[model samples]
Each structure stands twice: as C-alpha cells, then as structure tokens.
Target: MGKEHVIHTDGACRNNGRDNPQGAIGVHSERGSISERLPASMERHTNNMAEHAAINRGLKSAPYDNNPVVIKTDSELCQKTFGGGWAQQWERNGGRTAGGSKPANYDFVQDTMKEVNYRRSQGQDVRFEHVRGHAGDSGNQRAHDLAQQGLGQGAPQYKYGGRY
Candidate 1:
C-alpha cells in the first residue's frame, strides 16, 4: 500500500435556513484544494447540503489507487451518514429514510456513496474521521477559510500543490 493521504473538508452557508441562503464546500489535501459555491441548480441551499457536497467532492478528488485515504470532517451528520450505517440502511430502503421519505441531501448522499463504493471496489481503503470544528486544527481551519472564500468568489477556485 502507498502512504495514506489525509483530506480535510468543510462547508459553510451564509443566511442558512433562510431565503436566499448561499452554500459552499471546501476540500483540502496534500494534492490540492477546492473552494466552490454550490451550484445554483440545487433546489435547497442549507448547511447540511453544503456539508454533504464537501464530502462528495472530497471523495471524488481522492486518488484512485491502492493507497488509503482518510477524510476528516467536523460535521457529525456526515460522519454518521457515511460511517454509522445510515447510508447503507438508506440504500437498502431504496434511498428512503426509515420514515419512508427521502433523506435530506439525497443527491449529495448518493454521489458520496457512489464514490466510496467505487473506490472500495478498486481496493482503495477509504475512511472518514470526525474532527471537532474551530478547535485550531490547521487543516480544518484552512478548509474552513476556503469555504468562506467560496462565499465571496466569482468562480470556483482550484489550487494545486506538489504531490506527497
């Protein structure tokens, strides 16, 4: 196996839960960083949607080799959805929650799960870790900053770094 890679992801929403809320997602890793506002095409603009989008983007951006990838996120909802079998149960029920309704952020959840299953199918070890937000973790802080930046940007930003 190759060296493990760690990625930090975050989401932010200005005016969250109100009309005209704006959402963004941030992802940071040794390879690069991404900061982008959620596409306007999405019907809902909420913090949870942004969080799910961040995880999906992180999974899509991860390397597709045998190396392990660890994604750190502050959102317990994201952690639980991916790691606590919520996603599996939702999938088993045809993407409906136990309440017989589609889960919130269904599109993002499906996208994230698709990426995870694809990576695992190819022998990649993917994991998600829950990290306390705003606790001075540099990676998390950086990702948070990137998400904030997305809230101000004209276009999505992608910055690359030398591979580790």
Candidate 2:
C-alpha cells in the first residue's frame, strides 16, 4: 500500500431549509482544491445535499491509482453512508430507506457511490473519516472556507467527470 491521500471536504448553505436555499460544496487536498455552487439541476438545495456533493466531488478528484484515499468530512451522514455500508444497504433495498421512503439527497448519494465503486474496481482503497466541523482542523477549516466562498460564485463550469 502507498501513502494515504487525505482529502477534506465541506459544504455550506445560505438560507438553508427555507425558500430559495443556495448551497455549495468544497474539496481540499494536497494536490488542489475546489469551491463551486451546487448545480442548478439539483431539485432541492440544502446543506445535506451540499455535504454529499462535496464527497462526490472529492471522490471524483481522487487519483486513479492504488494508493489508499481517505476522505475527511464533518458530515457523519456522508461518512456512514459511503464508508459504513449505508449506501450498499440502501441500494440492496431498491434505493429506499427502511421506512420505504426515499432517502434525502439520494441522487448525490448514488453519485458518490459510483465514484467509490469505480475507485475500488481500480484497486484503490477508499475510506472516510469524520472530523468535527469548525474544530480548528486546518484541512477541514480550509474546506469550510472554500465552501463559504463558493456561495458567492456562480455554478461551476469545469466537469469533474461523473455520471451525476
């Protein structure tokens, strides 16, 4: 196994859970960083969506090599969903929760899963670590700041190469 690559991701939203919520996702790693508004195509804009989107983008940005990649995020949902088998179980259950209702941010969850499955197919070990938000972790702080900055920017033009 090669040295692990750590990428910190975060999300931010303005006026979340209200009318016309705007959200953004951020990704930061030793290689580079990304900050951009959530795509307009997303049906609803919420902080959770932004959080999942950040993990999706972060996974997409990971190198296509054999090195183990660790995704650090403040969102425990993201960590558990992708790293703790929630997605797999949800998928096995036809993308529905145990209550027979669709999970929130289901599309984003699938997108992240696709990236993770692809990376694993390529012999990459993907992991997720939960880092408490705004707790003075430099990488998480940088990702948070980037997501905040993304709120002011327009939608991203460059594609990170994913199905969704």
Candidate 3:
C-alpha cells in the first residue's frame, strides 16, 4: 500500500430494478488505473446502497491486508451508513413507516450493515470519504459508468481481478 491506495466504489440501479445491477470498484495505487467491476448484490436505486456497495467492494479488493482505505462517494446517506453512528433519526425512533422508510427496503440496509460490521471486525482499516460524484473524479466517474453499463446486460468484466 505504498502510493496512496485509493478505492473508489459505486453501485447502480435502473428504474428501481436490479435485473442488471452492477457495482464497480476502482483500486488505484497512486492514482494509476486498477479498476475492477465487482458483482452486484440486489438493485433498485437508493443512494445509500450504491455508496455502500462501492465502499464494501473497493475495500474488499485492496491489494494489501489491513491497509488504509479511502472510499470516495457522492451519497451522504452512504457516508453516514458506513462511517458508523446512528441510523436515520426516524428509524432510530421506530418510525420506519415515515420519512422515506419503507418496510421493503430497510431489510437490505440492515443486511448491508451486518456485512460492513463483519468486515470491520476482521481488522480492516476502512474509512468513508465523500467526493462530489459526476464532478469529474476519474475513478468515481469510471465506476459510475461501469455500473450503468452493468445495469444493461452481461456482467461487467473486471479490469483487475474477480476472474480468479
């Protein structure tokens, strides 16, 4: 993890359908290309899920163990989800029925949280950083592009790993 291991990850869902969902991670060793498209986990747009998927996949693909991870995402919800702390205020007060809370969606967020917690327990040095996506962040932009492509058809090919 010598030259700033930057992991840029993102997920995409088209029209609330994950039929062809995708999550791409760009692992940059000092800003040079090392982009890889990770397999998707359920779809349907939720800025939080996309952001979480990216961070999870990106960190999981780091080259060195226990290395620092810098997750660049555009979703604030994604940031709060992984950065630790409380869930949405409404959810915290058992108001899953209000303020964007839907009975069908909370499950995925909960499941993702479990996975994220497991990863943390495994001694992974993870940190979530926000980047204004689509603002020309190369890795982030590439990830989003790949995700949209994945949403179309044929699972995206990994530019770095995942074939093994």
Per-candidate TM-score against the hidden true structure: 0.92, 0.93, 0.59
lDDT of 2 by residue, 1-164 (tens): 99888999998889998988888888999889998887666767889988988888887887888999999999998888888888999999999988888999888788778888888898999999999998999999999999988888565732434543
What is candidate 3's local distance difference test score?
0.54
Q: Which residue pairs in candidate 1 have backbone atoms (N, alpha carbon, C) closer than 3 angstroms, thus clashing? A: none
How much lDDT does each candidate structure score? 0.84, 0.86, 0.54
lDDT per residue for candidate 1 within 33-120, as digits (tens), equals 8888887767768998888878888777887789998999999999999978899999999999999999998877876787788789
By lDDT, the candidates rank as: 2, 1, 3
lDDT winner among the candidates? 2
Q: Which stretches of candidate 2 lie over 4 Å from their true place?
A: 154-164
TM-score of 2: 0.93
Please report how far candidate 1 places residue 15 from its true position, in Å: 0.8
After superposition, the stretches of candidate 3 with alpha carbons farther than 4 Å from their true spots are: 1-3, 17-48, 64-66, 87-124, 156-164
How many steric clashes between backbone atoms does each model show? 0, 0, 0
Model 1: weakest 10-residue lDDT segment is 155-164
lDDT agreement of model 1 with the native = 0.84
